[model samples]
Target: MKKIFTLIATALMTVGANAQDAKFQIYTEVEPNTYAVTTNLDAVKAEFGEEKVTEAWGMGVWLPVDYVLIDNANLKATTAVDLTPIYFSGNKFTDMQKEFPAYTGYMNLGSSLGQNNWKGTEVIEDLTALKAAYHGAVSVFPKVDGTLSFGVYAGDNSRSIGIFNMATEDEMNEEIFMGAWANYYNFRHDGVEAAPDGTIPAKGSAAYVSAEVKAGRQYILVGGANKNLTMHQIKFVPAQGTGINNAGVSSEKTIEAVYTLGGIRTNGIGKGVNIVKYSDGTTVKIVK
Candidate 1:
């Protein structure tokens, strides 16, 4: 009896260890101008408070552009990848030149509106033309149900997280800072909310009511004080109970059936929000 019990215990321990090891295996991808990284879905949700994560699909994780591209070079290929310079106000260009000195890069979509003004009214100076600054600058994330998001900045900066979508326009913000001098964005899923008054609700305000995040427009943020933040890394966390293969492979049948939350069947997977039904009658949610 004792020997049998020992064998069973050892089996259980090995299984537990294997599960833990699976989370550390981060997956990465690189397209023409975009790169991505993903880790264990469940692990990310656990960190973001599974309850606060909306009920859609995908996740967004932001790190400084420098960290992701130049400094730390978290992604192996980014160090060698050429970042086409997009001149912003001539200052960003001069600064880059001064910093790199001997650098001669390609001309891509450079913004004259300094990196610090990505969230400022200047971004919409020409209301008709919304020129998105894409100097490897990641802006405007999609808000879906069950998605997790976090922000990263340089020099340990802290500022308000202004939530903007088309429906509400740019009139609302979440003062996501605890106190002055705080560095990281305090992800507040409860209590703190956005209102039409163009201000964030105070902490512990029970009367605060905010709209649910919807599709058709972007859900982006504007920092309280521009910390000179540039988009870094973005994470796509799989929704809970979705049998998403962390290894990034699924059955052929699973890829065939794609549906939106509105029950409309799409010919194939489209960008943005998508809920997928699997062959085993199990449904999973995803975003592109």
Candidate 2:
């Protein structure tokens, strides 16, 4: 009996090894001017043998593995790239001017249809670089500076307010990125492994969405606009539900009390002008 069990285990192990070795198979024609292999036999080449395989992350996250595999092997693989337009007109422009009721020139948000689009992969490390890139792509206003809100268009009608404030602003930061807005979410390959969360219909031949990172250039969509769309400030205290949200809350939070300005309290006396206490033991106050 022991001998029979050993034999069965060895057979299973061999089968598993073969399956792993032959992961994914294909048979296709090599195309002209298409790069499927590289000339270098020395260096590691998961990227490319011809030109470098630039991985364009449309949603800024998620892997493009299937796309990379096909592009890597196909003889006539042409890269699919999309340029995202950055619009300059503020929807609230007319209101702001009305509030001031004086600065007559700030009324209209001049060029509306378009400002210009970037390839989404543009290296915009900060506001300065972002402004410079937008201008470099195409300059409409004399200066793409503050007082101007920014929005990005993803073809069709989908859009996201890229910037609310250029000065000390930092949109697309780490905090609300992965959860709130999965910007440019796309598949790594044309036919990547099926995902649990992918939009698979009953027929199993439908579109999908995933949040993994791989290689190659593919397009994904951001679900909704990022909150407030304001970037990071230079030196301001962090605001609630804005700064980096690292963990999830398991329980409900209850507010303890709210104090009237300059009013005395018996339970917990605060020395400031106004004070607020919460079940989480958090105190918000304005100190003179």
Candidate 3:
């Protein structure tokens, strides 16, 4: 029995040795870009430069003089090659007096579609240096295989939001009905609000919407219609809770028993390495 157990453990170890531990990383820190509400002109000028500030004044108060670059310190952690300064394309204008999408705000912070209607506000993290068109929606390079979550706020008029990916920028165009979409409740205002009990409420404010994502791939998020929706935050995290195991085995199995390294049976997974036996006659080691 001892030799059999040793053989089982060794075989399992050999199979699990190549299993990559699950982890998650975001290209940029998830926070509200507050340039929309900034009131100090000098501070804005200091960060955005005097020339851009002057241009905004001449064009409009809410217009973007140029694309806003969002810096990412953890780019190399997820991406083998550093792709920093993700570009938030500014609102375009045909003439100095008229903005393409009326009431469109600057690109760095939050923006509104206004009458521009669903022209697809872009958030490009260009990995191929293609300098793709600015209307391809929310383009990002995910660092690991996980699910992308968007914390967003939308008024009553908000429409469906779609999530998908493309191999290269060449696949982007004005009309491409790619990926799946879901319409969620109108969670308006800044973010999820706290209830009277001080616990965070999940509805009627910014809420998390998830989509499937692959590691080292480019994904896009775009609104389905030209309506009132504002993205407050976005992030990615490892997917879990699926009915699968590290060895790619699929069985309707449940934990039958658990034992400590010292051969003592435990009620549940304790605070260290444990040997877990499943109903399917498979045993594996877990560390807490």
The global Cα lDDT (0 to 1) of model 2 is 0.21
| Model 3: residues with Cα > 4 Å off, grouped in runs | 1-44, 54-136, 169-204, 239-288
So what's the TM-score on candidate 2? 0.21
Error of 1 at 37 (Å): 8.2
Number of the top TM-score candidate: 3
For model 3, where is the 10-residue window of minimal lDDT? Answer: 1-10
- Candidate 1 yields a Cα-based lDDT of 0.29
Largest lDDT belongs to which candidate? 3
Worst 10 residues of 1 by lDDT: 4-13
Q: Tell me the tens digit of each residue's lDDT in model 2 across 26-102.
A: 11111121111111111112212212212211111111112221111101111111122111123332332333222
- What does candidate 1 score on TM? 0.28
Each prediction's Cα lDDT score?
Answer: 0.29, 0.21, 0.35
Off by over 4 Å in 2: 1-114, 126-128, 131-160, 163-252, 260-275, 283-288
Lowest lDDT block of 10, candidate 2 = 4-13
Per-prediction CA RMSD (Å): 21.9, 26.9, 18.6
Better of 1 and 3 by lDDT: 3
Predicted candidate 1 versus true structure: per-residue lDDT over 74-192, tens digit per residue: 11111111222211122223433343222222112222333331332332212112223333322333333223232322222222333333222232233231111111133222334
Q: Which one wins by TM-score: 2 or 3?
A: 3
